[model samples]
Target: METITENQKVRAAKKLKKMFGHVDLRDTSLICPIRDVMAVASDKWSILIVLYLGYFPVLRFNELKKKVYGISNKVLSERLKHLEGDGYLKRTMYPEVPVRVEYKLTDFGHSYLQKLIELTEWAETHKNCVISNRTSYHGS
Candidate 1:
């Protein structure tokens, strides 16, 4: 992990406090809504779905399944619905012999993808450090 300066930690805490608006650490009421909203977008399946949708302008259900790899139909369907309901993505249905469906990111989702891209880049940079730490911790 990269070493974070005390100033950086303080700045991050200040930003979080500004966003959360005077949250008390013991108060679950204020935290729950933010946690719920974050959970929908930050789950592994939802992250993959959003990333793939960002990569490809449009994708069908089966195509997403193939790209995401190992997500079950039920979980994918649930995550897609949650993401759509939250305005991150849109789902369109076409009336045809097979009744085709397509998924694509909204402007909101694209904006969120920028954040995800930064996080993915950070993870890529720190992955080796994280692995080494994990190995050392486990060995100890």
Candidate 2:
């Protein structure tokens, strides 16, 4: 990690202490809702899935699996189901000789994906600095 100077540490401590106010560390009731919302897209697979759907208007299950490498079927299925359940995606099943299913982002999901795109760009900008910080912190 980029080492924080004593001055920075003191300033951060003061800000955190003031922000805590009367709330105990164990009392996370206030931030729980926001945390819960963020938890949905807090994983690699979920973020990739969102990005994929954003780029492609629609995609098949197998195509998604292929694009997001190393993701197990079970995990992909769970992610899709959860995203769909959370109103982030639309699942369409076609009645055919066998069966066909497609997934696409809803309007709300598209909006979220746009935000994620911004986050991705920000990360790309800081990626080198973050890697350097990690390497120095680990001393490896």
Candidate 3:
């Protein structure tokens, strides 16, 4: 993988600060672009669901529930509904004997997937540093 430039790191830091600069531990408002994006993107199940959808072009509800692992039916259902409502997922219901349904990514979801891949890559590169930092913090 290609290396991330210093400029990109600085820009990301600035953006994160801007997103969280308000410093509210109790609640958040969707007042800024960064907050709006992070609000949904940083949710517990959102990234996992998006990743699974990215990996599989299309999947049924049961398949998603099984693949995500440890996600309850209720949580999975809620997350799917939330994601679909947010325009990240496209749900298609087929007129069949038993009524088949499938879920896939919308164009916006695909774009978000690309950003996630980049973030994952950045994490991989800095993983050792992160581990060292955690160890130092805990060991001291």
Predicted model with the maximum lDDT: 1
The TM-score values for the models, in the order shown, are 0.93, 0.79, 0.76
> Ranking under lDDT, best-scoring first?
1, 2, 3
Write the number of the candidate with greater lDDT, choosing between 1 and 2: 1
In candidate 1, stretches whose alpha carbon ends up further than 4 angstroms from where it belongs are none
- Model 3: weakest 10-residue lDDT segment is 25-34
Model 1 lDDT per residue over 40-69, tens place: 999999999999999999999999999999
Per-residue lDDT of 2 in model 1: 72
Error of 1 at 22 (Å): 1.8
Best by TM-score: 1
> What Cα-based lDDT does every candidate model obtain?
0.95, 0.91, 0.87
The better-scoring model by TM-score among 1 and 3 is: 1
Q: Give candidate 2 misplaced runs (Cα > 4 Å).
A: 1-25
Q: Give the candidate order by descending TM-score.
A: 1, 2, 3
- Per-model root-mean-square deviation over C-alphas: 1.5, 4.7, 4.2
- Superior by TM-score: candidate 2 or candidate 3: 2
Clashing pairs in model 2, backbone N/Cα/C closer than 3 A: none
Query: How does model 1 fare in lDDT?
Result: 0.95
